[model samples]
Target chain A: MVHFLKHNYQDKDYFFLWDVESGSLHNMDSVAFLCAKKRYDKTLSPNEEIEYKKISSKDKDEINAFFNQMEESGSLNSPPRVTYFKKNPDIVKALCLNICHDCNMRCAYCFAKDGSYNTAKEYMTFEVAKKAVDFLIENSGERKNLEIDFFGGEPLLNLDVIKKTVEYAKKAAAARGKVFHFTTTTNCALLDKETADYLNREMVNIVLSLDGRKATHERVRKCLDKTVKYEDLLKKAVYIKEIRGDKSYYVRGTFTVKNLDFSKDIIALNDAGFDQISIEPVVLEESSPLAIRKEHIDEINKEYERFANIYLDRRKTSKWFNFFHFMVDLDFGPCVNKRLTGCGAGTEYLSVSPSGEIYPCHQFVGMEDFIIGDVFIGIKRPEIRKKFSEICVLTKEKCQNCFAKYYCGGGCIANAHKFGEGMDAIYELSCHMTKKRLELSLAIAGIEKLYSINA
Target chain B: HIVTLFKSSLDKNHKTGCGECQSQSCKIHKKM
Candidate 1:
C-alpha cells in the first residue's frame, strides 16, 4: 500500500522544488515536499505580469496580442495555465556539502577530474570547512530540519572535518529548534570498526555502492592488485547495520547492463545483509549513453523484467534487486519548484571543490568554465549570479513544448547544452526511457495493490 | 564543430567523476 500510494501520482497536479540554491538533485522530491497551503508564484516583470493577466482575462485576440508582445520583448515569464503544485519553503530542506575534492577510491567512471582533481587525494583544510559551517549556521533561517549529506572523492577520508562541522551544525540547528541528520554514499573502501562506530554514533545513514557481485564490481571498481573489493564492502555493510541497528541505513548497489545476466551479486549483497535496495542502470554520459545498443536495451529490459519478478516474489527479509527496481519506484509528475525545478545547477545548489571552487554537482567538479562561484566571495556574487542566470534556460524552447517538461525537467545544463537541444529539446531517448519507467512503476503498483500480491 | 565545442566546454566546466547527468537525465531521475 505504501509503495502503491507513493508511486501513484495521478493526484499530484504540480511538481515543486525548494531552496534550490542548496538542494541536491537527488532526494529533492522528499526534501522539497511542502504543505499544499502554499501556491506557486510565477516570476514575471510588472509589464509582463500585466500583459499575462490581461491576456488571461481578455478575449483570444487580446491574448494573442499580449503573447506576441511578450515574444517581441523576449519576456516569456508566465506559462499558460497548467497544473499547479504548491511549494511552501517553511523549513530547511537538505544540504549537500562537497566537503572536499578528495576520494579514497578511483572508480573508473569518475568525471570529477580535469587537469585538476579526479583523484581521491586532495582535501579542504579545516579553516575552509569551519568557515562554511559558520556561514550556514549563522544565516540559517526557517531551516527547521536539515539533512546534511557529505559528498566528495570519499567523505569518509575527511572524517575529522565533517565531524567538526557536524558538531557546530547540530548545535546551530538545535539552537534554532531544528533537527539534523547526516548521510553519505561511499564506495565503502574505508569502513573499519573505528570508522563504522563513529558513523553509527553520528547517526549517519550510509549508502555503500556494490554494483552487483565480484566479477561485475571488479570490472570497474578495483584496488592495488585488481582485487575484488566485495568482501570488505559486504563485511562493512553487515557490520554497519549491526552496529547502527537501523534498518534505514541503505546498503545497495547499482547494476549496469554488463551484469544483466548476473543476479548472484544481488543475492550476495542481500546475504551480506542490507534491507533497502537501489538498483539503477549505469547512466553513462550522454556522449557514451551507457553503451546501450538497441538490442542491448531490449535484452536488458527483458532481463530487468525477469530480475524484478524475483525481487517482488522473494519472501526474504533482505531486499535484492535484479534491474527494474529503480524504474518501478518513482512518481512521474512535474517537479514541485516554481523558480527552478528542472536543473538545480547555478540556482539552488552548487558543488564545491576542496579549494572552494564550485561546479554544478560532484560529476561536474572543478571544471574551470563551469565554476559558478568561489568560497572566498560566495555563490551570491553578481558574476556567479550572472553565470547562474545564463544557465537557467531549460525552459527555453524544446523543453517547454515537450509533455515531459514537467516530468523530465530538461535534464542538466552541461550535457544537453549542445545537440541542438536547449533545456527544451524534444523527448530524447532518455526521456522515453523515463516515461516507460513511470508506466512500469504504475503497473507494478496497480498490480501489487489490486491483486494484493505484496500482502 | 558543435561536438568539439560541447566537449571542450564539458571539460572546462565539468570535472569528471561527477555524475554524468549530461542534462535532464540527472535531475529527471531524481525528480521523478
Candidate 2:
C-alpha cells in the first residue's frame, strides 16, 4: 500500500515515497526505505521483521512514527495516479519555427536530418513565417506571454525571415494585448556584427553552440568543407558576448565518445568568459562513433562530479557561472506538475517546419508519422495530441518505479524513440546518466546551501 | 501539508524549470 521508489547510489540506498493522492515526495533514509519497500512489495519476511524490530527502540520508534504519518496522510493505501492534461489545442503558448531547412555547417551529429531534414535546402518564406506567428498568437488562448523560437539548420541563414517574423509578431502580440519573447539557437559561425546587433536590440535569448575544446568541437561541428577553425567561432562568440552581454546568452556544447572528459570543455568554455555554459551528450544512432556507449558512462559520471566541484569552487569566488543542469532543486518534484511528460510537446508546445508542416516538437519535424497539423489548418491530429498529453512517468512502466522519475519525467520521448524504444520508454544510458547527474547536483546544492549560510 | 513540507525544504533560489522547456523543441536538454 505504501508506494515508494528506491535508488542505490554510492552503496547507500535512498528512497522517495510518493503520496499518490497528493503528488508529494518524501525523502526516506535506508531504514524507512527498506520498511516501505517491504510494505509496498508485500515481502516482509519473518526474519526481516524481527531484524527491523531489533534496530534499537529509538530507531524503531522513528520508523513507526514515519509509518503512522504516512497512514494518517492517506498515502498508505492510495494507488498512483497518472497526471493528465485536458488537451485544449487552442491554448498554444509556445511555437518553434523551423525557419531554415538548410544549415551552413554540416555537423556530424546534426539530428535535423543532417541539418536539412534530408530535403531540398530551402528557407521559410516571410509569408509562412508570418502565418506561423499569427497561428501562435491566435491559438494562444488567454495567455499573456507567448514564446516563439526561431530554429533551423541554422536560423541565422534566414536572418531576414527572423527579422520579419519578429517585426510582425511584435505588432500582432501588441494588438492582442499579449507579450512575445523571441529566442534563437545558432552555431555562431555566421553571427556578424549586424546580426548580433539586431539580436541584441531585439533582446532575443541566444543559445550559442561551441563544443568545448577546439579539437572536440571541430571533430563533430565542422564547416561543409571541414576547414572552419575554432578561433573563428570563438571570436564570434566573444563578439556576441559583447553585444548581448553575459546574462542574455548561453554557450552550449556537446560531449560524445570523442570527448568523454567533457568537464574540461566546461572549464574551457568558462575560461572563454562564458558565464552560462551547457554541455550536452550527442544523441546519435547506437552504431555511430559519437554515440555514448555504456562503457563511457563511468567517465561521464566523473566528469559531472568534476564539473560540480569546479562550479562550486568558482561560486565561492563570486564567479557567477551556471552549468545548465546543476541549477535544479532536488526538493522540487518536477519542473511542471501540469503534465506528466518531460515537456508539453504536442499539446501546449508545437514546432512548425519551414514548409508549414506541424510536428510534435523540433526533433519530429521531418518525420511523417509525427505531423500533427499545418499552419493554415491548425492541429489536425487531436488524438496524437491527447496521446502526448497522457504520457507521464506513471504511464512509463520503468519510470513509475524509478527513483529519478519526478526529476527526469521518465526521460525524453524523442530520445526513447531514437534508441528504438517506445515513446513511454526511456533510453537506459540517459536514465543512468540523469540519475548520476541528479545525485551530483544534489550534493553540490547541499554544499552551496552550507556555504551560503556560512557566508 | 506534504506539498508545504516539500516546498519549504526546497532551496528558494533553486531553479526548478527545465532549461530545455524554453527551447520547446528539445525533449531532453541535459545530456551527460
Candidate 3:
C-alpha cells in the first residue's frame, strides 16, 4: 500500500509524479497517502471521500490493485492539492502593441467597430509605445530571452513606431545586456523593398495575414476601392519570401473559415522559397461581423488539418513553437486531453496593448473587459493575477479528473470565460483538437526523422 | 494498431465540426 513512501514528504503538500504503474496521477498529499496506508485493511472506494486508519494486508493489496487499474485506463485517483505554476516565474516571449488600429483593408469578420470599415483612426502614440517597451523591460528584466511583437491597424501604418520600438529595444537590450525576438503579424499590404530590407536586417519575422489563394483572400479582406487585395498581397508575398533569403522570415498566412482549403496556398508557399508558415482558424467572437456557424469551425478545422499535414510533412513549420506548444502536453506526446487543457495564461507570457492596458495575449486585446491591469498603476493594483490564481486552483475538477488533463493542463482562459464555462468545465473540444494536433505533429516528426538523409 | 493519424482522422473531423459553427459568428457560439 505504501510502495512509494510519502513519510518524508509534508503531510499536506501534493506530489505530481508518475506512480509505480507508470501512470500520471496526483495521489493526494503526503498526509493523505499516509492516511490511506493507515487504513490499509479497510474496503477502499476510489470515489468515496474518507479518512485513514491502520488496516490489514488483504485490503491493502485490493486498494493498490484498484489504483493501478485506474492508472492503466488514464484516470486520476483524486484532485491535485498542490500547484507548481503558481510559484514559477514567466519569460516574456513577445509583447505586441496595437500600433495601428486603422487598417486600410476592412476584413469582413472584424469584431471591433472602430476598425478599417468604421474609420476609427485609433493609433498608438509614441509615448504609449514607449510604455509598452517599458512594460517589457520592467516586467521581464529577470529573463534573458525576450521578444517585442508589433501588432496593427496594419502596423506598417505606424511603421515609424515599429522601427523606433525595434531600434530602441535593441539598444535597451544591449544596455541591460539582454536580447530580443522581434516579430509582427501584418496584412502584407505594406511589404515593400524598404520594409523587407529592414525586416531581414533585423531578422524580424513578417507574419502576413492572407487567408489563402486570391479568390479566398479577396472574399474577406477588401480595400476602400472595393478592390480585392489578393493579387497585391500575392505579389508582396512573393517579394517578401524571395528577398528574405530565409523561409522562416516570410511567415505569411491567413485566418478565416474559407482558408481551411490551403493546400494550393501551402504548395505555393513551399515552392516560392518562403516556408515556415503559421495558420489559425479565424477566432469567432460575439461582436464579429459575420454570423459564423458551427459548420464554419468544422470546415476550418478540416482545412487547417489538411494544411497542417502538408506543411508539417514538408518540415515547413514545427508545431512546437506556435500551435502545438499551446495545444499539447509536452510529456504526453499529445495535448492533455482534459477539459481545461492549456498553459498559464495570465501567469505565463502576458500581453500589453498600446493603451498601457495589460491583457493575457494579443488575441484577448480590444475586449476591454479582459484587461487585467494598466501601465500607470502596475500589476500590484490589479486583480488579474488574483482571478488567474483562483482559476488555476481549479485543477482537480475538470483537469485532474479527466484523462487528458496532464497533457492539456488547462485551456485558454479567454475561451473558458467566453463560453460562460468556469475553468472547471469538463473536457472542452479544444482538448480533443489539441491532442489530435500534437499526435499528428509528432507522427510527422517521427516520419521525417526516419527518412531524413541528415538523420 | 488503433493509433489514429491526427491529420487524417481527428483534425479533419474537427474541421468539419468547426465549419458548421463558422456560420454562426460566435455570438451564440464563440468557440470549439
TM-score of chain A of each: 0.67, 0.83, 0.66
**In terms of docking quality, how is candidate 3 classified?**
incorrect
Query: Is 1 or 3 the stronger prediction by lDDT?
Result: 3
Off by over 4 Å in 3: A1-84, A87-94, A111-120, A225-228, A250-265, A271-273, A285-344, A389-396, A401-409, A420-429, A449-455, B1-32
Categorize the docking of model 1.
incorrect
Please give the range of 10 consecutive residues that has the lowest summed lDDT in model 3 chain A: A1-10
Q: Which candidate has the top score in TM-score?
A: 2
lDDT of 1 by residue, A93-128 (tens): 444567766555555555553213544457777677
Scored against the true structure, residue A141 in model 1 reaches a CA lDDT of 53
Residue A218's lDDT within candidate 2 is 80
**What is the C-alpha lDDT profile of model 3 across A1-455, one tens digit per residue?**
11222111112222222221122323344334543444432444453334333434565576556556544544323234223333123333346667766777777766444343233467777777777777677776455556666776677888887788777878877888667777776777777888867876775466777665567667777875455356777777767767766435544455554555656765655554544555444445644544334445566456545654555445544422233222322223321111222344564456666567777665567666667776666564346655564454244364544333334446666666654265435325455555445434443443333345335
For model 2, residues A1-455, the per-residue Cα lDDT tens digits are 23445444435444566443443345656676666655666676787677666567676567767667766654454443434423344468788899999888878888886578877788899999888988888887777778888888999889988888899999999999988889889998788888888887885588899999888888888776456578988989878887775447888988889888898898888888888889988888889988888888888887786677677778667566888877664344343443244556787789998899888899888888899889988778877887877676767777665645556755778888867377867688888888787666655554555345458
lDDT of residue A320 for candidate 3: 23
As a whole number from 0 to 100, the lDDT of residue A242 in candidate 2 is 71
**C-alpha RMSD in Å of predicted model 3 compared with the true structure:** 13.7
- Give the candidate number with the greatest DockQ: 2
Model-by-model DockQ, in order: 0.03, 0.10, 0.02
Give fnat (model 1). 0.01
Give the interface-residue alpha carbon RMSD of model 3.
17.1
